[model samples]
Target: MAYTGEVEVGGPPDVHELTDLIITKAAVGPMDNNAYVLRCRATDEQLLIDAAAEPHTLLEVIGADGIGAVVTTHRHRDHWQALAEVVAATGARTYAGRLDAPALPVPTDVPVDDGDTISFGRIRLTARHLVGHTPGSIVLVYDDPHGHPHVFTGDCLFPGGVGNTHDDPAAFTSLLTGVTAKLFDVLPDESWVYPGHGRDTTLGDERPHLAEWRERGW
Candidate 1:
């Protein structure tokens, strides 16, 4: 409801109805990476997405009993710097792409693949592999009770920019192609996109911009 200063925490009405999916920003300025805490209301099953730099605050919001799993978006430390700390506090299982497994300090409980569905109570998180910034990058899709989908697009799709280029130029091309075909093409216009950085946008808003963006290149 009310945000004080350095910290802000609240769950909207719909969020509470399905799961305690709270979005928190880490930086003081524009480039803040977004992290989420999803807690199932009925079963109290909790999962975290990206740890960022504020694990202590993230822990305070989700607490101990609720968290069961954590799914990292990529291998970038900024998106997952405090993962080990939070995992230690909550004893939650960690899931990441197999390519990112070696970089993580803890062993991954689940190596996510494209099209894999992770369920908790009424919520279902579907993994869509989009490898541009990282070979194993993924965007998660969760459908609300009303059937409206919310995409947690890590570094893949930002408000106005896609993710940065990888070591291999082919990887970047593949990433953009996958996102355009798998994400932009398939998802409905009304679907919400919660990117890793900046504010939220919709498929409707992004669709028109895609042609121009593609011409200019990532």
Candidate 2:
């Protein structure tokens, strides 16, 4: 089937194959959180983004290859519900934004900051920090040499608008500003966005609505 990037809880994952990487996205937990398993085609080394929930399902997806690292996108509880179990089972190293690391259930082996590079096998992801939903929310960017860049947006950027800021104007502004400068400005429109939940969208698809999101002040 085509890679639509749409997934449902308890259903099969949607797999998107790149030149050198294989991205398998699955929706887990009652909240329908999306967890991505990125496997490097060259080495078969895998890295999981957002353990979210359903350790058994995640473990099944991981299989016998085992995971090398797990990254928690932010400090939100829903994002890391299965962190402990996943880590305990796979013994994967944990990575999260420095500011949000301490709050996570598992100890962060690598406390990342903006511009930090996370490597697993031949694949490399650049961590970009965007504050708003949480103080240390981050999105991982993989600039594929064979194709357009792909981003794993935790709870930061979604299909329609930015993540929730709890109606705080300052927070909303900060998030919007970071998103604009770090993402929209730096990346190309064709960049594929894999959000933390719901369906996927392209940067081109959401760029025109920036002002509207600002005016709405979500």
Candidate 3:
């Protein structure tokens, strides 16, 4: 991949520390949406998470050398507008949630729903069905070859916020209760959270904010 700007910026978290798990954030599109690249250094395997915008920027970071697959978080344009462009670049297959199939550009080769795992070399990513922002929204969890477990949350949950509400009030409520009961209830407090935008955070930092989020009816 070729990037016009530095792939690593801000230097808040040492890139070397995350060497085993190569994660690069690219600001794609005019909305400045983030498209992430997750690579297993041990195997040089890569997965592009959320091909929403900025195909060139994302490609630059992942490079043209190695890309195993591309995973979409939801159906929103900010989450998948550049998917077709990405697939064309690396010949990588994409995985989308079943409910998001209708919004995908090419539905023929896409994988639907959850409980499916995409593995590259020694890295295995388990897809969890996390519906909130969309009925098909999912969270990808994996244990890097180096032994740290990380979760790619998409837009489901953010550092100081949650995904926006859906049209139906009942659906929004379900999204909240479902995730809080299923995902957040079981994951470790220290688990790392990589949202679709902004900075990375730990579950510990977000736990307290859940109450306020729920109170605000988000």
Among the numbered candidates, top TM-score falls to 2
Q: What TM-score would each prediction reach against the true structure?
A: 0.85, 0.99, 0.85
Model 1 lDDT tens row, 134-185: 8788889986756567888988987675788744567667777888898888
What ranges in model 1 sit over 4 Å off?
1-31, 166-169
Q: In model 2, state the lDDT of residue 197.
A: 94
lDDT tens readout by residue for model 3, 1-218: 43222233322222323646667666565665667777777888888888877676667777767587888888888788778888888888778888876777866256656678877656777887877678888888875555556788888877776777765666667777766775678777777777777667777788878778777787
After superposing candidate 2, which stretches have Cα over 4 Å from the reference?
none
Deviation of model 2 at 47, angstroms: 0.2
Q: What lDDT does candidate 2 reach at residue 40?
A: 100
Q: Write down the RMSD of all candidates, one decimal each.
A: 4.0, 0.5, 4.2
Candidate that scores best on lDDT: 2
Question: For model 2, how does the per-residue alpha-carbon lDDT over 12-77 read when each residue is reduced to its tens digit?
Answer: 999999999999999998899999999999999999999999999999999999999999999999
Q: If both were scored by lDDT, which would come out higher, candidate 1 or candidate 3?
A: 1
Candidate 2 clash pair list = none
